[model samples]
Target: MPVLTAECDPRNIASIALLKKLRFEQTGYAEKNFDYGGIEMCDTAYFELKRKT
Candidate 1:
């Protein structure tokens, strides 16, 4: 089996904690944020979770 990953706002402490609780691991990070609508966030953090085999 493979794994799933996601990118989330680095400023969201609660979301980060929840992902960790869900067995996700920190995988990658981006210092520059993407422009959304008309605003940009601090940064993006990546996470990954391997599927049970």
Candidate 2:
């Protein structure tokens, strides 16, 4: 089967570690803003991942 990849928050240390353990690589990044309750927050960092063969 072909390998699949996904993107997630790098702020989540556990998830980043798991992806590294699985051989995922940082390919690109993007900016995103989200609203929680009544507050808006923005993130500026590389948040992309890819499978490494």
Clash number for each model? 0, 0
Error of 1 at 31 (Å): 1.1
Across residues 1-53, which tens digit of lDDT does each residue of candidate 2 receive?
Answer: 35556566547678777777877666655565543355645443343344345
For model 2, the local distance difference test gives: 0.57
lDDT of each: 0.88, 0.57
Could you tell me the TM-score of candidate 2? 0.54
Q: How well does model 1 score by local distance difference test?
A: 0.88
Please provide, for model 1 over 6-41, each residue's C-alpha lDDT reduced to its tens digit, 9 standing for 90 to 100. 889888899999999999999989887766667654
User: Where does candidate 2 stray beyond 4 Å?
Assistant: 33-53
Alpha-carbon TM-score of each model against the true structure: 0.82, 0.54
* RMSD versus native structure for model 2: 3.9
For model 1, state the Cα shift of residue 12 in Å: 0.3
